[model samples]
Target: MPRILAIDYGQKRTGIAVTDEMQIIASGLTTVPTHTLIDFLKNYFEKEKVEAVLIGEPKQMNGQPSQSASIIKGFATHFSNIFPEMKVVRVDERFTSKMAFQTMIDSGLNKKQRQNKALIDEISATILLQDYLRQK
Candidate 1:
């Protein structure tokens, strides 16, 4: 089976994660600049047998869409338009970033490491992928 890919979309940087061919074990792929995300995905799709993409959808405490939500939605639309063969799904990402930061702290990452927002983004992508897999 083709693998599943997940994206933690951010304004400046986008984190990427992927599942194995069997759709198990979501792992961090990389963090890339937001502007280059579409090109990056195009290249990655050419190289990998990707079936679908899961993007993180941000929401507020009252269940309203966050500021970043529109950007993510735009990206998701562009992604779908560009790669019509692949399916795109948006998963609610409420506390994945906070959870990733706390996980980094619990994993004994130093202060400097914890300060790396890209790392947290990547971890959040992983978390989002795991959540998608669980639902499946």
Candidate 2:
């Protein structure tokens, strides 16, 4: 099976992760500026056999749509338009960033690394992908 990719979209930065060809494991790919994410994914999908894409659907504690949801929805629309061959899926991303920070702390990352928002994005994407894997 073709590998799957996950996107953790933020206003300033975006985190990326990908599944193994077998779709069993998720690995952090890279972090990029939000403005450049589409171009990056375009290039990546051209070179990699990506079967689907997963985007984190940010939501509020009350289950209302978060402010970031609009931006993510726009990205999803553009992603589908750009890569009609690939399927796009959205997964709940509540508290994924918090989980990412906890994961970093548990992994012994120091204060500096733990504070790095870029790392959080990557971990968030991984969490999103892992959740997807679990549901499958």
Candidate 3:
């Protein structure tokens, strides 16, 4: 079975996570610069069989799409055009960042370690993937 990939997209950086070939465990892959995300995904796809890519969809507490929705929409459109065979999924990502931060704290990470935005992004991506798996 091909694995599923998850993305936590940000303005400056994007976090990537992937499931095992069995699609059981979701693990953080890496964080790449936002500008380099497409290239990164292309390179990763060359080495791995990905069944789908989950893109985080940010929404407000009031059930409204967040401002970042436009950016994600544009990227998703371009991604589909580039890799028509790949499946694209949008998952609600409300409070993922806060949950990731709390996870870091619970893991006993130091303040400096907690300050790494890339790490937070990675954790967020992992959380997004795990949640998706649970729902599936």
Compare the candidates by TM-score and give the number of the best one: 3
What does the lDDT come to for candidate 2?
Answer: 0.93
Off by over 4 Å in 3: none
List pairs with backbone clashes in candidate 3. Answer: none
CA-lDDT, candidates in order: 0.92, 0.93, 0.94
lDDT of each residue in 11-75, candidate 1, tens digit only? 89999999999998899999999899889998999899998899889999888999988988988
List runs of model 1 lying over 4 Å from the truth.
none
Worst 10 residues of 1 by lDDT: 75-84
| Comparison by TM-score, 1 against 3, better one | 3
Per-candidate TM equals 0.96, 0.96, 0.98
Encode model 3's per-residue lDDT on 1-136: one tens digit a residue: 9999999999899999999999999999999999999999999999999999999999999989999899988888988999899999999999999999999999999999999999999999999999999999
lDDT ranking of the models = 3, 2, 1
Candidate 1 residue-pair clash tally: 0
**Candidate 3 to native Cα RMSD, angstroms:** 0.7
Instruction: Please report the candidate that would top lDDT against the real structure.
Output: 3
Q: Compared to the true structure, candidate 3 yields what TM-score? A: 0.98
